[model samples]
Target: MENERNEDPTDWDQIGFIISSKYRTAVLEQLVDGPSIPSSIASRTSLPITHVSRALRSLRERSLVELLVSKEKRKGRIYGVTEEGKRLWERIEAEGMVD
Candidate 1:
């Protein structure tokens, strides 16, 4: 979906800042079910591995979610949603229902 439109810079920025792209939203949804590896996220979301990785990087930069841990020799890195991420998920779901 396209980003919500708003003339007020702050209002637009508030939502747009969280989900700047569809891939980012997909990444968030994957985490909502539970923590999983990036590969798992890609499989579940049907997003390209490269896109998922990029989205995860952006999410991490914003502190919306975090890599909980890496297991078994730096493989199977589990990611979890932070408090802010949850709130954003709620907003996205709510808006989706309206749409």
Candidate 2:
């Protein structure tokens, strides 16, 4: 879906910062196709759950990622990239920001 928010040039800096971490980049890569839980992401990326959790938090704070379920639930809090996130992901891919 198209992002409702206008693209901000400064968002490049935030995107750059987020993808700078290998774990966060891996997390984003996994989410590109669809939403997933932290455990799934960690397993797929072969990263620790704690690390993935941290990455998700950072992504959420940037509005690049969002939780699909209640925080209190905890067991299956699905995370997906926002429309703005998709736009940023495309830019990052076009620029070859990460492999």
Q: Judged by TM-score, which candidate is best?
A: 2
RMSD of each: 5.6, 4.8
lDDT of each: 0.77, 0.87
- Residue-level lDDT tens digits of model 1 in 54-93: 9888888887779897535477778898887877688768
Candidate 1 Cα outliers beyond 4 Å, as residue runs: 1-14, 70-73, 97-99
TM-score of each: 0.76, 0.87
Cα displacement (Å) at residue 8, model 2: 3.1
Error in Å for residue 96 of model 2? 0.9
- lDDT for residue 35 in candidate 2, whole number 0-100: 98
Please, what's the RMSD in Å of model 1?
5.6
Worst lDDT run of 10 residues, candidate 2, spans 1-10
Assess candidate 2 and give its TM-score to the true structure.
Answer: 0.87
User: What's model 1's lDDT at 15?
Assistant: 53
